[model samples]
Target: MSRWIVVLAALLTFSSAGAQTLKVRHDHDPWGKCVGELSFSENGIVFSSEKEEHNWSWGWTDIQTVDRRSESEFSILSYADQKFLLGRDRPFDFTVLEGRGMDDTILGLIQSHLPRPVVDRLPEEVERVDYEVNVKHLHTFGGCEGVLRFGPDVVVYDTSHAKDARTWRMGSAIVGVWSVGKFDLELEVYEREGGDLLRTRRFRFQLKEPLDPDFYYHLRRKLVPVR
Candidate 1:
């Protein structure tokens, strides 16, 4: 009947496929923090804590989305509301304390399980791209520099601004894509912004090289098919 008992019971069901585990620091507030192990498995994600009250388990269906704000930091947003936070959904923010932060392999695994868009800022160490071009990602004021790499089923924007960089799976994260001039393009993705679910975010890019018709047409056809 205890809360931790339920959490442990759920954890036991996981047939951990080596159960990718990460050492994480979950800071509850300025003065309080819980150091724990976050394990991603076939069942769901579970946080094991020494402080029993802080322990929790979430199934894939209960997750709203996952945000990889940066390589070392990420948050798992869930549908459950926190009574203390004025009924807003509480996000489990974690900072990786060990190993190579999050890589594409981990993100790929997580995205495959949850039918939700994930924000990935880390770039792959090695990738074979169908097309790649130097581009400037436009912001409200100035912008950041990055390379826009398009693969068969992926679109990656890797930038010097690590926080600005993003890797989006074409079919899952991307909603649509468009281009205006031969040098400007935009990509739309599903995101929860300002507490809005599935609210789309557009990233506009100014291509350093002319947007080749071959690449643009292929990407556009994939984003928006002919009726």
Candidate 2:
């Protein structure tokens, strides 16, 4: 009927014939390791490390980050702080049928399921952009290198290795914004205590490139309306 319907049908057919169960070595930190079967389906990712006794499954929403550790290895960090390593040798076999490497394929699937940056959900009239910045959390003094994406109503900070990430909704979690210099900006956000804003914490970030002279000014302007 419609062009959109044709596109949707193609996608459905492709997905139904795509790769599913993959046998690889599975590693569970501090729990030992075993050869297991990993599968990707509509119900998220499921894995069976040892028969039916040691199997686990996680929905796409349960995953927090996926970091490529090396050319041949990657790690999945779940929201519960559990880490799973997959690769060709360290933990899993990368080789699959037709001499294809499954690492990249699996990675693509995971990335597609990750939450979009705040700017992505902005109204069409709002201008938004993404930038890489060096960041430091003031409370823990932790060095968190990541990209910052901002718009009129929201800001999302995501670490390079996906070690830490947060989406701050202006007026709800953002408390203050300060310009350190042409290249740096500081964001003060509310620290949550049992799902409630209990205190304020600061994070400092310096833009990776200082080409935009009015970057900080524009960011401040965006925050004002939302705050």
Clashes of 2: 0
Best by lDDT: 1
Q: Give residue 109's lDDT in candidate 2 (0 to 100).
A: 62
User: What range of 10 consecutive residues in model 1 has the weakest lDDT sum?
Assistant: 9-18
List RMSD in Å for every model shown: 7.5, 9.7
Quote each prediction's TM-score. Answer: 0.84, 0.44
- lDDT per residue for candidate 2 within 1-227, as digits (tens), equals 99999999999998875646666555555465566666766556777776577577778776543444332333444445213422212222122323223454554565455542111111122246444444543335446566676656657776654434665666455767887566667887755222121346676776665625466666666666653
lDDT of 1 by residue, 108-224 (tens): 678889878887766754366888999999989999998988888778888889877877888888988888899999999887776545468999999999999988898888878
Model 2 clash pairs are none
* Model 1 misplaced stretches (Cα beyond 4 Å): 1-18, 29-31, 194-198
Which candidate achieves the best TM-score against the true structure?
1
- Residue 179 CA error for candidate 1 (Å)? 1.0
Local distance difference test, each candidate: 0.82, 0.53
lDDT at 9, model 1: 75
